[model samples]
Target: MVLYKNEPLTGHPCSRPMARECVATLPASYFSDPKVFNLELQAIWSREWIYACHENRLRMTSPLEMTLATFPISLCLSESGSVAGSLNALTGKPDSRRIHTHVLNGFVFVNFSDAPPPFESTHVGLADEFKSVEHVFTEAEFDFWGHLSLPGAFNWKVFSDNYNECYHCPTSHPQFSKVYKIPSYVVDAREGYFVHSVEERQEGGKAAAASNASVTELLLTESNESFPMEAKRLYDESYSALNQKIKEYAKANPPRARAKAHEGGLFVHVFPNVGINVFGDFVTTLRWNPASHEKTLLQLEVFVRKGVSEAEMLRFSNFLKWVEIEDYVLCEATQKNLALGVYQVGVLHPFRENGLVHSQAQIRKRLVEYVSQERELKEKVGKQRDSSTTLSEESGTLLN
Candidate 1:
């Protein structure tokens, strides 16, 4: 489907088109229909290079067994310490076919197809962006903190739709709104991915200071009045112990600050299912694991500098989880509404939700192709059957 945007004619600033063009989202059936989900698995999931994990997770002693888009895969360390993956059958045994695996910037990607598209060419925009900020993701400079997997009762596309735009961020993510300048946030869609960039609110800015004060006040009240006497004592002692550990850890490992391109945040969303979030002191990988049409597992893996304190990391994790939960609620509600017969389609803001527009366009293109292929296959089979019937009739007539 071709979509057009309203634009001013060249050299005629006042000649703006009067017609308002709006991009419509995919039909609601795409979200909850099992048949559409199966088509996506065959066309999009199987052909795309799905992000698996960081190389650090792989060990020579034991292979990592996990499911990617419901396909079981086992990743192992090769003799040269590189990543290798194998597709497993229903019996939990490796099949003769080997899954195609590629490692880029220490992150592993797997494709279930026999002949997958060239990674760099297929993901030109993502590759270029990663190359530009290559210094920030050097494997040796960071440690894998851990991973968080949150299951949701929504389609993977719902999460992708939520991630593709920040229009709802201000109202949906209050804490996040204070930390980042929402007005300046931008999501630029490229060839095969989307880039999200935003500047942080100034450290001493009124908004930042107010947010910090509120958080401090909340923590103090919770620790002091909300807990029982014994619990309060335990909390106080734990806080002190954690502070000491932070100090000791900081002393042992001084901060190794790396130069960044700018004092802003950067995120890349590779089409189908991967996100790379880059921050000042840490990086995270986000994946949407689709189990069914209405189920998805959101996975987040954190990698931080060695000098980051345990307390700080914990706080960051908590904040991330909070934001994710807020999003989950919204997505789940949206999913439920979509499943209802009341709504079949919705309009998208051409500029604000352009990322979502791009994503849906990609999906629509793939499904269209799948439908075309199915039609051709049926036609071919029908022709062969007709030919076989004609030959049998001719043989029987000649014998009579």
Candidate 2:
């Protein structure tokens, strides 16, 4: 059970468990090695349920399968009435760089996103008039898994790992803490989800402390009587009150962003390589596939872009984009520094980082399974060769 690779890195724990830390200690060469990464790519990704299309992606045709690079995909909904997609890894063919196409029954189908105008499901329609989904071949996703960053992202694991905890808000994310208060750290993953989990830590230990401190403050309130009323006074909050000047000072620094309803719903990573952000209007289905061990391909689709008011769309886009940027910068920073000669792999804040630990545990388990199977195959092959050699020697002896 090699939990933390022997290396060193620098990054504050994104969650509580104050002493817990992470050092991008996973070796850089591992990412450079195709073999190590491919193992993770195949066993963990292919066998898992990646985020395909969000619930609202298709008013017409829903996605059936989504694959990581080229494997059994569920991103394309291939229900009888829905469109089906296929990709074959051809080596010597004319268009051999991984072909992705749609077909119904045995006939090639058209992609609606690429249709010039009047886009409709192609059944018995003319092939000549249809244009290929050009993005399929040249999209940034092709490079998503091989580089440190992309046109639209830096590293995705930040989003996955960050969504797993909210422990840093009180200090690191002053802007964010104002709006949301978190207490619990473990991710109460959605039911039936095998890979990812969403954690909410609202109303934490600080709340209790606040309640206890209020008794003394209340007496001071009656005697000192000359109290200056402020926006978030000691007892201003609904349930608790605070006694210290430090807590008051901390609150004053940044007026917490007023929280609206959970219009921007929670996001969930579908293990291995897909993410889903369930917001107010619609959820987003984001796919990240390994372009290489260190890089990944990302796809973003808004499942419910329709029926949204312009205002809500703008707000959603702004918040989502900003949050992603914040996460990307951190993930990349960790990825880059992880290869340094001095960083050590650290533990997840078990309470807050359960999802991250779960993900790591899952990856480790799969690695063990796949490596074991490979070893078995090599042993079998070696035994066959030895048996064949013995048979040949026996034949020579018999003939002689």
Give the winner by lDDT.
1
* TM-score winner: 1
**lDDT at residue 207 of model 1 (Cα atoms):** 38
lDDT of 2: 0.39
TM-score of each: 0.78, 0.52
Clashing pairs in 1: none
Candidate 2 lDDT over residue span 221-290, tens digit each: 2344333332113222311221132234334432233233323344445455555444433445556655
Q: Model-by-model lDDT, in order?
A: 0.70, 0.39
Query: Which portions of model 2 show Cα errors greater than 4 Å?
Result: 1-34, 54-67, 70-80, 93-159, 168-175, 189-266, 305-307, 383-400
